[model samples]
Target: MTTSRGGDGQSSVEVGTFIKTPSAHIVEILAVAGLDFAVLDAEHAPFDFGTLDAMLIAGKAAGLPLFVRVPDFQPSTLLRSLDLGAAGVLVPHVDTPEDARNVVARCRYKAGVRGYSGGSRSSGYGEKGMLAAVADAESVQIMCQIESIEAVDNTRAIAATQGVDGIFVGRADLALSMGLADSQHPDVLKATERAIAAGVSQGKRIGVVASSLEERKRYSDLGATWFLHGSDQSLLKQAARALVRA
Candidate 1:
């Protein structure tokens, strides 16, 4: 999808949702629904590698950029997801510049440790040579999730790390870390603002998981360029509740 520029010359905000259900059809549906992107929640959802492979294929077939939220900082997991053809990977719990640097290293090939594989889907199934494959791999986005107070404090350094494409604020986990029940707690908001500002200072794209359109707008005004709204299951539940009410 083409990114439009806002009046202020910044890229227009992109809105996507999480995919919790392990279904390729669901991926197709999200693509047809015209969302900006879809992030498969591998960290919290029950998604087997085979299912993930199918979902990624569906996303590619339907023209949707699919990102995988990996369970952790495992290099093998990151490499496998990239090989499966995800547009990007959202690494969770990156609380320091050191962590960010390690993630970048694992996701790259030239100056990093990602294993070479020309047969992977990302490499056009061996059609692309080694040089082309490495270049394509380097183009994949790497978004580090800033979910803890420590991460918020280290936001600038994390964003400044070479090869980190963006920062995705994880408010729910941040709230839990802060010993709060509400993701919208004032302290959480303050920390999130600080993190966003830090990312912006480094000229990095900022992202957040907002619970509603209003919350999304609030963060957007604070310079978050992308948002992940409710997940597939959450949307289904909401629609079912509405149907019952109707």
Candidate 2:
């Protein structure tokens, strides 16, 4: 994880990568790259439960903090991901304070309604014991995705929600909300700026997906600390296309 100035200015940044496929090789590569974390894009990817669990196990073996981008804010979805040993969860389409709070509640054992299970993989299959599993649940990070116009409008409240660890700006979705195809448009940039400022005001870590190195620098300048470079499939396709041309 490369350290950058967080929205709070005092806090540091955490860098991560996103993967669509549940591939152990890809998880190992992320570990070798020394990324602070890796997120499995379950929101967009059709990952079967078995594959997802295997990927999480692979990530643990590699000592990489693995997170899951659940398709929705459903408690069961969050619970399943955590039960499988995810270090954290990224909840999509969190448009209001209530949404943010619900996510936190579902993620944390102390605050949320996540079911307790000591025999789960997160508890080392009963090796760590129930007490340790409870502690782990409390420590699980909850990142709320700020994407739509409503979410941008409520950024401050969302960031201030207790148990919410960070805010992730979904640039593509934000662009769609603004009726633009390009996330780099001025309108999207302005919205992201506002979201970042709001998150910073509350001392929350702000994250964004950078389409390129330039975009990463741009978001960093705006006080975004967590940077997700892109997805595994995209990178693989880009490399293959280049090789074909060469």
Candidate 3:
């Protein structure tokens, strides 16, 4: 796990939070809520790289692991995200060996030539311990999204790609790719399970975004150690309901 800036920068285990939708205050909210890590969703959400940096700053202020889920398999985007100081990066649609390598390289520094700016949130905004920070960026957390049949089929090879830290199953998108309207179908469940199992055997941490605590438990039982429990919108709806009940 990457050590955050402050606020009990003292924890050991890694807890990752996903930010799929947008809100300027999301980073501050989740950070104060005690999340070990938080991700900005650039894939499906409307967040630009600049906004991502801002969110990272907010999360870091609270000592939360700051990460960004880049839009696609583009190395430039991934490189930009890493340079901005994402504690880690979640690359979506990792369906091939090349895609996996692309992301892995983005995390790398000198050996890979990712552009650098010393004074940024990523390198403690200065030269202080920048080399160590670069090393951490290379080996830190790299989560690949399993969201299609291609990824499901290429699971073993994808995991074998050196430097990948974990897997996050995108059930909804995978279902859509498989021509299913939703993730409730048994077929999608089987595919998701297969991916999770493959990840476990390969010694990679497995994860998914569960819609509820029950769903979280179910996936946890299936050996997913990393869980991005739900979306910003879902949390809001649940909180609103609770407030109404209260």
What RMSD, rounded to one decimal, does every model reach?
1.3, 2.5, 4.3
| Winner by TM-score between candidate 3 and candidate 2 | 2
TM-scores, each model vs. reference: 0.97, 0.92, 0.87
lDDT of 3 at 144: 91
Task: Give candidate 2 regions above 4 Å deviation.
Answer: 1-10
lDDT of 1 by residue, 116-228 (tens): 88889988899989889998888889999999999999999999999998999999999999999888899999999999999999988899988888888888888898889
Looking at model 2, residue 34 earns an lDDT score of: 89
lDDT of 3 by residue, 1-246 (tens): 632333643212345566866655877788778776777878778888778777776766677777788887576887778777677788889998778877787677756656666776667667657777676566657889999999998887788788888888999999999999889799999999999888877877787877667887787777776777666777888899999999
Worst 10 residues of 1 by lDDT: 1-10
* Model 1 misplacement above 4 A: 1-4
TM-score of 2: 0.92
Residue-wise C-alpha lDDT for candidate 2, range 57-125, written one tens digit per residue = 899999998889999878889889989988888889999999988888888777568888878998888
Best by lDDT: 1
Q: State the TM-score for model 3.
A: 0.87
